[model samples]
Target: MTSSSSDRPLLGRRSLLGLGLGLGLGASFALAACGDPGQAGTGGSAAGGTLKWGWALPTSWDPVFSSAGWDVHSLSLVYAGLTKLDEQGTAVPALASAWKFSTDGTSVTFTLRPGLTFSDGSPLDAAAVKKSLDRGRTEAKSLVAPQLTSVREVSAPDAQTVLLELSRPDYQIPNLLAGKTGMIVNPKAFESDAAGLATRPAGAGPFTLTSYTQNAKAVLRRNPAYWDASAIKLENFEVHPLPDAATVVAGLQSGQFDVAQIPGSQVAAAKAAGLEVQVIPSLVVAVLDVNVEKAPFDNPKVVEALKFAIDREALLKTQLFGYGEVNHQPFPKGYVGYDPASADLYRYDPAKARALLTEAGHPDGVDLTLTTTAAQGLPEQLQAQLKEVGIRATIDVVPAAQATQIVYIQHAKALFTDQFAGRDSAAQAFQVLFGEQGLMNPGRRTPPELAAAVEQVSRTPLDSPEYPKVLRAATALAVRTMPNTFLYSVPRLLARRKSVSPVPAFTAVQRFEGVTAS
Candidate 1:
């Protein structure tokens, strides 16, 4: 059964430390309690030293302005969100000690933990929370704002209490609060120049931002006055950007790094070397984006032909090394609203693909230019497979730095890219990528049905059993329309030195509060 967002209770500042009493039980138990700040690092040995982490993307310290790269990991260290997800994807409290929903489900109220202060020794209260959230809404044109769009206003009823009034009854508001985009900041430190503060940050998380150099490295120091300092054992941490996969593997082998993100093909080799390998299935999917507003793709038959020509099963087994799940629908498995029956939309048949091409006036096959990036999983191999099917497909392998620009800015016709649906709600996924106002909408046109469905889902209450039904119907329509041919969800792989004692469970999002180097 899918887990509900409101099942878990919020953890207050003092109560979190009390949870540490259950540490050292076992790895399973340790991962389960990771959301509780007091219970964080219970199963790991305390080793006070620097921890070096490596990834392919460089660090962009600013949370609001930056979309991709290592900004999420960097901001995670310095800022805390109102709510956080546990191993099972349940929402638990972080900055807010406890929260509750009104009987109508249109509003939520949070009680703050007294004495909590920012890294710069500023008081963390209801007013500060309002400032941080307001900035994200105004500056970034944040996708996260939609979750709060229903919120009519935010008011501090008392010194410790915050109340949010919404225009509609919705249950996923707390889940949205748990996302990285919702991490809180101090008004005192950033009120002067919100845009300028992207380079320098001040928050009440476990770590403090010491220095950041664009495209180089991000350095962090443990917050000495952090409310949960006892749970954070690492004195210093460094995240270095290594764009080349080979270089990342070499760094791991040469002992230049303790933890590094290895490609799926290199997982076996890393395990053979006796490194602690943790592979977490990600919610990311590789899709072939067609410009619906342009000619050719504007025809549904051409889009249907493209969908059937590619074999999803082959991509899942060969390219992903059986580390992915086949998906024709936009919603991935484990999502609360997913319907397995939607897989019937696309069946692999090369003969049928050629027949459809003929029907579309391309007898032999269509000559199309396909664009993809090396950063996406198995793009080169996927390009070769498409060529075998009689489609005169030419692959344009662009650099990772230029890929987003080529797709979003340059408006390239047929590009390969990966998108993530961090929330289980289908409305959240659809509204972000396919909706008329969505940032990634290539067609630049919003389907009326999709727009109406998104509106319905947004207004539905969490306790209503029909919520899943509404999401399933909307997803089915989206898949049949072929907005972008849905692909398999990618797994997230994390490697750590075996000596590190405390490790959190690998879920949709990677949590670091419980990790410790022994």
Candidate 2:
């Protein structure tokens, strides 16, 4: 939920290819034939200079109040949570050195690392943690409210100990704390109405915001008093917020920026131009939101048919330049609950798809509209794939804002091509995309079997021995019901000058924790 509207451009800009989408196929094919990706570029040592990052500006610097991806991305450079999520979505220590959940699962106790303080010279103690968490839980405008809905109370039992009591048994608390919900704030710097924290943000991160120019850029200087001062390699960290993909590419091309989030379609071009293209396997997935509550897709056989109609491997190769891996389940491989067996459920077989379609009473195939944002040649690629299985897919392209309104708000009954990135856990993703309250399940039409599986996955303790089984079962049920056809996980590509040694990031949000550029 921390992602903003401008964060939706996984595909390259329509203008970058110097042609409209009608010419997308030619451009993509021509670009795909340019060179071998593996041999495109290589790595080098950091040059030890000021690291300049060209990216979209954050919507707000206040972590609790901001849901924009760019906002969280920028705030991360200036904030630290109690826990941090690893590349595999595992919870590791940050502010909190240790934590333990009660046997009954109603309360979790945490022990803070000794002698932590915010950059504002205020103590980052248990009381500060409680105050920040309480505000996040109680604030009506907080974007993380849904993630903290199970919390009953937050208490600071002692100077270094914090107790979190929940209304129900919830195991994802640690993971939640590793994200925006657990990003602590300085009580002295923030006001009751949540005013003035953006320009003058305060945190215990390795860097301190020296200046912030709205819609333009933010400059961060090393926090001399930071607990992990040794990790601060760069003397100055500068971020330029530029939303347009073309503009970002131009910046990278013109040597104006040392790093930028380059689109997948531009990876080859960036590499050819001598930029090091680093691939970050994003948590974001491209999915066809099949309207299982309506006709055509309502039938399970029809859903199965639709799933088998597309070639995921080819799609990844042509659409993403083979930058990402193919995934059949909604959860990618690194995330918890992702089953390798699920990949076998839907293979690219037109004969099988047509057979299933015939069994579902559509002998001549079904006519459906696949609506999506202007995602380069994705719609056309999907349309051609679906046509091979005797299905007629009409493409409807809309702007990103209007597309969100149509799919999430209007509950449009079309095969909506959507890109989703969410909390690290598979259960959290299910809750957002397929649960009874999920965005795609507007009618709450989750099958009884899947509903029970989702419940089990939600209630099961993550560390319990039964966790993997329960998660796998939930994933299997989800695939069977087929509310959404899983496509490949999109690769978040970035271009950096060879002089920079970018720290490898598993997810899209780039962390410069140990990175440096000369």
Candidate 3:
């Protein structure tokens, strides 16, 4: 893999970096020309043109059922939530102009921006907000349902006000609402058959879906009556589904696309071709997950040995091409509650790994299978690394569905997977990957100290001084337990033409929301 120097600064700390990014978005937005891309007439020099966007296509057009990041991007162009996250994962206002939590922090009230109307010419009122959230929670196939763990009830008191009552004091609710689950769909669509709506959906975003071809392309035209017409510079927006990273990069260079997502390995290649690339150091981490309920993994010494065996620095430099940050704890460094010291628990040492394995009764060797979703050359690298430490790891390439089944359902001994926080909060990350109630915790067994620490962090106010201390304790416990071998937080890269400027905000899919095509 070729490595390149990025114009964007490398993220030294996760939380501080995130806050800085969010503040940048909140400061101001640039103006773009307004008009159709295909037309000649224009009012503003920076506005009135079409933006042709190309990225990995979404599997489903329905926001509730869509799981892939690309799908969220496509859906976000048409649908919007009450709150939207900035680049730092901070919640900024979107549909709802502002909100306030009760003194007890159990309920929140939202006030919608006035004069709002859906693309279909219906009022975007409090009732619509209630309906959208209820449907998202009730839908059987919705992958977003889990994010609403704290939502107990959603009620509309009047046309413009909506209230959400939570079961506990979850400060992360606003952040969660800024995510995919909070996307509001047309209530009329919900009244009809749910499956049919997947084919045709409606929302009140800056763009209207004029036409869609599943997993192929989606054509969008500007919503003439959009509440924020000034920001809707692009008269037309087109989304093409191109999943292959190399293919997407080639398309950008060939002028087939104005913007596209490319892997870190291709960042240098894209930059060398004179394309403008923006790198966002996000909370996405790739690691080898171990099922503690399984045989050898049930032993703590065996787990520690595996962590010390792999050369994480080499893996990041080679596999990720230096577009990532090495981390050994469940939460990436710099994130709120992450301990910098936890990363030093296990250093790369083949001899120490072999000694630990021998002490754990694997004198000869240990055989295990590492399941993954066909990551390029990663499985082979993992296998070779394990071999050096008296562990034989066979790679099994499978689709995501199959891999999920093997790791989550079938209780496979170990698997290589990537984990990310939907929200910026470390408490949420803990609940998903290490919490007893976490989906990844197949057996629901958790170390008591880790569980207590997570609980403390979740309940403590974000402004409280004790919050950081609680998170540090949680990070320490998580690293000591070695639930999984931490790897690196992969950097997200985007390559766009110099004429196109990316919006600073973050949508669910990180699409071209506020982008301007000059």
Candidate 4:
């Protein structure tokens, strides 16, 4: 068949990618943008004016029902979470000030800040927090439901206290609540105008989303009524969908964008243009997931063989401009679940890949596709590397917004590349990536060994000395059995005008609460 976005697969539901480039919403967000924060753009200028930041626009503005994990950043502008994560991946205060776990370890209580109100002038009390979290677990088609399954019940003991009762002794609640699952929705808006919320803000966050234009920009103004309004340094905060690399750098130089997320490849270009750059070690990892129910890859030997074909170090060095670390497991280094044994399990060897492919009944060769987003040079390099080992991989580039729907939900592609925006907790990441309902698992079934190992992790307390061992055991089983292949851990390369101060670093998505300018 001809290689096109509409072409039939040489590899059915078992394979996906070809350089068949199509443009729409995905084209505008080649995931890079440019402009000097020194020059102001449009309605506002720099720090005290408007922080014209280039990042991404969310598929859904509402947190409870948002599809993509990266949407947490956009959603955070309008809604406040029960807790927020710090640079160390520890849960700190947001709306909830202090929390304590019960003596039995099965229950935990959160103390909400006194007199907090939503932007819509509704009280953000304990009952509202309970309702929001309950919807996270029970809402139809909720993306966060899987991450919150351990919590069997949620109740508000008093106006200021919210309690969660777990099915077991899971001690990762605080961390798990750091992102979308932990965001507290305003109950009044859901009751009055739920549909309106898809475009507007109701929650008590730092900024109230004023205007959102699709595939273009989200215009937000600081909320004067915010609980900690003084922390918001900018009068306005605008986020645009980062476009092509050239367009991004051009925009930055022209003062069209103040702060933009540029590719690692463009750091030198940005720096030479008199812009400032910061390479923050982030939890973002790229994964190659396969459908084990299909041919070639369906065989265990071939599955293992493909592992040898990936040159993680080379990919890191070439594609990332040496700004990333080679990783074989989902968890990045310093994470408790990061396993050294898993990292040492696989290495790049084309001859070994070829030998294993021949042994698995493919002496001639194997042809497949390597699907990815519009991240310019990486997919082509992967395609070249795979070809050397007799795996001719076509490149398929999907749009950022539609990736989760087409690959993970519909399972249309046999094997696809996924860029994971790391979760708040290890268990949360495991549930979302390896569980039956995990977004990464198109197979939708966890093996018995993996299930048992993960269960041991869930039952163990997060602070327990043995927690890391149990979590590692689960990760190790997944690495050996699952068809999902982890490539590397890459940092988010951010560039700003000299006027802007250094952006705060967080484990997962970034928040603009502390970003300031001269």
Candidate 5:
């Protein structure tokens, strides 16, 4: 049964809110309350400035080679997607003025914004966009490749227009193009220096890479040639990946960082220090990936046992500090894809987990390793919870930069846990999380029933009144059948000085469009 539209924050394609996430979801708490998000952020200085941001750097500057999903946040600095998500996650025009689908929905056309140019002074026209998108879909190592499987061809109809031919009817294209999947790069730069993009980037974004140090810091200068350069207030922006909570607090207190991301535990500390804290809903979701090919998980009963073994509520309240809600599926509440049926599907029943383990031939217990990165913040708590059900889980902490390569690519462990930065479209999010050959699915096979349900969602248009209903059903199926299980939906917790405006945010990506002092 379909829930009331009120449960969803739907702003259709015609409006600013994309795929139903809302600007007014009662989100973004600041200093206990945010008077009006529309009002300029109060504490920051109200003039041209430089923002010293404490954020995790993405794996690579080149979107095609970037491995982590949250890398979209970092890539957005030097690269602008063809379209951007509004406060509600809707596909709003950025590089493109407008876009539309054909009568059959198998093809779409985008009208490029006039006079757009790359940061290096190259024309960012239809041909450049087609080239970049083609590279994303065709490049073997492109992490965004799974998101574009339905896209058969990319063509430039004219200097002002680009066309996409789909292998099937797909209305999710525009929203999918809103982030990393749609970010267009300068063709000349890549054609001449593809490898260099791992460190240096060239695009039509608000900023340009001035300097970069792997896993340390990156300095960027405002792009004078950006399409809406006049709207950009900061002259310089520097990003430091300080994943440590203590470091974030120290940086904020020392005035070394005007803006820094902190764990939910630091919310009170930030407020006590007179810093404005913006804790807003994000597309980020924490997920546990089980390698079905591995011994313990190879048995269906063992995988099912894990579903009941995890204590999601405890983790959310204790480890997460009650900042985010427990989630059974990848899509969070208030999203069009949220599935009510998935609620309480596997609610912390250790007895049931043990029974399933016994049925799976592990009469005594099961031994396994759970690999996680420090940035995930889900430490010993997860390990301790699993022990209750006779699942002896050894925890291995991997480096943030090497986690994906180690587990997803190397298959170094039987299980992995990390927070996935969500994609712009529900279809793309589903694909990356559940589809065959998905980065998260190292086992490389999606259960057929769940696959069919997801396929229907991909074909349905978000503007269709039935879109949410279809997506919800698919979400439920994913949780019920897939080895991957979601724990909770997390927000991007940030503390910023009164001198700088609250950093503009939606999902994992934060923008400095109007971050000048007030």
Candidate 6:
């Protein structure tokens, strides 16, 4: 039966109050109250000092339109996602207090918490939630809205209640919500043309955007009227964009920056300098993407040959400086439903590669161009490795700004790229890179089995008995197809000052709320 929108229940004042209290508790105590080391309750440990952080990308304040890496740090300070993943990679409630899924799993009901307000003192309720989501759906330029295609309709039963009707069952919906694209915004602050507001953003997070300068630095201050102001430690946060690795390392060592993201090669040096180094293994994989429709790669044998030619083990050890894990497929090892059996497909064999190349009508050798970006970690090393196996490779390094659209969007022939698959879920990773109409599916075609598996896995309930089995099979099939050659999973290295206490477990996400300056 098609459920009527009127069937949804109105959110109550008590429920909103409870939600407000819960949020207040979460913001104030979830990280510190857990009895973590170097952490204290309520008042900050640093006694109200400014903390500076650094990264390798320019600062962009727009959460919706901006795709820059450093911009995420700035946006995160102002915005909050509907849900967040815990250390174990499980999706937990964030903005939404709790949610209930229908038996068929086609619908989801979210009960809103009370007394939630935006940074600008505007009310945040079910109607506001609907407006924020609807804007993403209708806006073509929004990177986030595309991920919510499964959402057929959103209804507000009352001021604090939200009901979502999906076209199909989606167990990974929560993970999507935890992503940057799922950050909630005040409907009143949203502008259809967000270009002007990209410099200044408004949201309901622990911190507020105070000032920003593109490609230089961004400054954030504690929200005085924040729902949970007691939990915030440092009075202000300064995020500096230093694209150079040396500059980031120097900043962290000199104590100019309290926290910094250093390149993998610099991890050992930073650790030697007596800084707290938290090495979180990233879900990101460096891959050699081929345009299946384009010439040369159209031949399956050539694709197989290219896969066999590259040495993933050597790349992981030497090129990555042993900071990453060698992966045989898109899904990394240790992820839920990852198939150990699939490792055999990626075995290094130069002789077999030569044979495959000869069979693909390139007997002597194949001359192909390899396009990569300079900031992509180890593309040059990959090019040199490909050359040893009789393939003449020419490296074309493009700027990081234009690489995504030029390589993935434009379907450049042989591009070297890296993709960070945030969570360890097969459904989320597969959908992002290989689903029929996925954003990164440069091949632009889906295999029948892969399509069926993705659909089945997407509909499986989070707690279903068949969930793990179906996920394993789907991942195995994707590996065999070789849509993109999986190389390795990079390790995310964080250099933080020793005085900061209460560090959360290293997951794909790094949350600053849990941190307290001493």
How do the predictions measure up, each by TM-score?
0.85, 0.82, 0.85, 0.87, 0.87, 0.86
- Per-residue lDDT for 80-99 in model 3, tens only? 78876565455667888877
Report the lDDT tens digits of candidate 5 across residue range 1-518.
11111122332111001111112222221111111212222213233668888876766778887655556777888888777777667777788887878878899888887777787767789999999999999887676676788899999989999999999988778778877788898999789989767767778787878777665678787777666666678877888876577667767878888888898889998889989999888777788888898988989999999989999999999877999998877767777777888877888899999999999999898999888766344758888888998999888877754666677677667888766666777777776677786667777779888888878977776677888888889888888778887888888788998998767766535677777753
Determine which window of 10 residues in candidate 6 has minimal summed lDDT.
Answer: 12-21
Query: What residue runs in model 3 are displaced by over 4 Å at the alpha carbon?
Result: 1-46, 224-229, 330-333, 410-413, 419-425, 502-513
Best by lDDT: 5
Go through the candidates in order and give each one's C-alpha lDDT.
Answer: 0.62, 0.69, 0.67, 0.73, 0.75, 0.64
Error of 5 at 363 (Å): 3.7
**lDDT score, candidate 4, position 505:** 70
lDDT of 1 by residue, 80-194 (tens): 7776666655566677777778876788888777766777667778888877777676654453464456667777887677887878765566666665556787887666766
Question: Which pairs of residues collide in candidate 6?
Answer: 16-114
Clashes of 5: 13
Q: In model 2, where is the ten-residue run with the lowest total lDDT?
A: 11-20
Q: What is the lDDT of residue 249 in candidate 1?
A: 60
Candidate 6, 1-518: lDDT as tens digits: 11112121100000000000011111111111111112222334443767787763222344555553224445666776665556555666667777778888888887766766666667778888788777766666665565677889989999877888999887667666665556677776675445444555666666776666555566777654444456567677777765367766677777788888777777787888888888775455666667777767888898888889888888888766888788877655666666788866868898888889899999887887777656344666676777777788777877665676676566665545555453324465676567665545667777988889978887876566677678778878887874678787766677888876645653545566656775
* Model 1 CA lDDT for position 137: 67
